[model samples]
Target: MIIAVIGAGYVGLITALCLAKIGKSVICFDMQTDKIESLKNGIAPFLEPGLPELLQEATNSGKVKFTSNINDLKDSSIAFVCVGTPNDPKTGSSDLSYLYSAIESLENVLSQSSTIVIKSTVPIGTGEDIYKKYPKKLSFASCPEFLREGSAIYDFMNPERIIIGTRNDQDKSRIIDIFGYFKDKAEFVHTNVTTAEMIKYAANSFLAMKVGFINEMARLCDSFDANIKDVSLGIGLDSRIGKAFLNPGPGFGGSCFPKDVKALSTTAQNHAKELPIINNILVSNQMHKEYLADFIVKIAQKYNQNNIGILGVTFKANTDDMRDSASLTILPMLKSKGLNAIIYDPAYTNSKPKELDNFNFVNNLQGVLDSTKIIVVLTEWSEFKGLNFNSDAIIIDFRNIYCISDMQKQNIKYYNLGRLNEGAN
Candidate 1:
């Protein structure tokens, strides 16, 4: 099958590469010329564990081609739309401008037998609306992607469920054919377009809630002088909780959870309905970020040190995605109170984000080690584990990557979430 994958962003590119890896001929298109050029040379603009290898294999096999021209995709029978629906921080609503653009662009080239599979996470009833808009020839199906950033390749190859949301069996079968080898990876959920759209939001919202719930409990643990790890283990062992997103940290931030939760809440508000839990997830998350900043600043001031050390900046480990990391908010807050940080993360050794131009970054772990005052571990990268540090340094392990006993043996004061930071008081 000649597969046309649209919008070559994180999800789209992964979709294209994976389809190519499955031995299907793919033509991936993106409006961004720079991105298209990079993909043509087998270089992924973003970081994923197994992407480079996959890109190399696909490129060598000549199964996938990247292009900026839309005409290159005209001959494909199946088109997967993987554009992003970025959420506005101020309005807490998703901007579907990119999705609309991709569809309009696809409409010009899509054939009568072509099935437009919508893989982007959109608001409910979007599939039906798009079908109505182009009812002449193109058939629509909502096949929302649930791929995680760091492990996108693995997740793509082994999804827990494959959702095909279309009222038409013909449309559903066409979407199913696109996942030829992956149909047995999990259950094939055939449902109406609305139900499939709601499933994506519901899954992300619930996961975000799990993250929020654990973080809130960590706060309570802090107040009561309790250990949150034990609490998490006990609560998570329950069959009901099942223990997936229960890890306590600064908070949850990524492409999916934050945006999807906000969109779901915003959708409720637009319909003049209320979702108390969904609405307050963002509020509570922001509050936690602020509280963490306050805690770090208060504790760091005792040493009267102006320079602090940061271990990670990306949202979480194994990928270079820094869309909404807690370190972005917390580090700036520390700066406002007169503290400078030297950061080192495995992801940003060669390149640095221009948005963080104000802060200083080092290319190696030893650079951050130069500052012995206080070291804040932000993202929980595996490289930061089991490392020796200066004996006089103070450690604030935000992601719980360090051992409290090891810190005590070295006579370094250690503070972790929910274990109680006596230094803050």
Candidate 2:
């Protein structure tokens, strides 16, 4: 089967590569000429674990191809819309400019009776709107992708469930057949298109709420002199609560959770409905970044130094995406207080970090630590897990990289987001 994936971003690239590995021919369409040129040379625009190898293998095998021309989507049996729907500045709602553009572009070239799948995260009722736009000539379905960064290929290949929402039985059957490429590996759930769209936003918002709830607990624990790790462990052991997304950090900052949560809340308010939990989740995460900034400021004030070292700059480990990263928010707060923060991320390449202002980027770990008075473990990379803490240098381990026992044994003054410090021996 021939599949065309629009927008060679994280979702588009990962989906196209994975589907090609399963013997399907894929054409990845993007508007950026440079990105397409890079892909043709076997270079991925962004750094993702295992994607480079997979993309190279697919290209070598003649299974996958990349092009900037929309004409390349012709003769494709299935078209997947994976373009970005970034958050808007005005209303915090999801901006669908890219999505609308993609549809209009496809409408000009799409073959009659072609199936279009929406893999991008959109608000509820978006599927119905898209279905209305194309009418009977084109088959539309909302097959919202549930893949995470850093592990996107694995998640796509081994999805927990594949949900396809269609209004008609014929459309549903065609959708199921296309997904038959999975060969019973994934559980298929069929529902109305609106429900499928809602699932993506709902799932992302729930995870965001969980992070905010734990961070709030961490704040109260700090005030009462209690250990949050112990409390979280006790609660997480319950089968009902499950321990994922329980670890608190500077805040939840990534492409999906932050944007989707706000979009979902905005959608609810538009209909005169109340979503206090969702609204609070967004506000609480913002405050969490400020709290982390204040924590670092307090440590910097003690030494009377204006320089601070940041260990990791990305949102999470194993991925180099810095979009909406908590460090971006927290760094500005520190700079406003007269602290010039130096950042060191091993994956900092091809992107200019100097343009961010009030911050200096270092390529080496030792260089950042040597020049600054204190170290802030922001992203929780595995390399930061076993650092020597015996030095008198103050450290604020925001992602809980150091255990309380080890920090005390090494006499390291450390503070974490959720866990209380055991104090230096």
- Give per-candidate clash totals: 0, 0
The candidate maximizing TM-score is: 1
Candidate 1 lDDT tens digits, 1-425:
69999988779988998988888899999999999999888788898998899889989999999999998888998889998899977777888889889999888887787888889999998888888877465888888899898889999999889988987888887777777688667889999889999999999999888898999998888888688888999998999988788888888887788889989999999999989999999888888988888888877777777788999998889989888777778888888988888989899998787657888889999888875578888888888999888888888888987878888899988988987556477
TM-score of each: 0.97, 0.95
How far in Å is the alpha carbon of 158 misplaced in model 1? 1.2
Q: Give the least accurate 10-residue stretch of model 1, judged by summed lDDT.
A: 416-425
For model 2, how does the per-residue alpha-carbon lDDT over 21-53 read when each residue is reduced to its tens digit?
A: 988888999999999999999998887889889
Among the numbered candidates, top lDDT falls to 1
lDDT of 2 at 101: 92
Count: clashes, candidate 1: 0
Segments of candidate 1 deviating more than 4 angstroms? 135-137, 420-423
Model 2: how far is 391 from its true place, Å? 1.0
Q: Work out candidate 2's RMSD over C-alphas.
A: 2.1
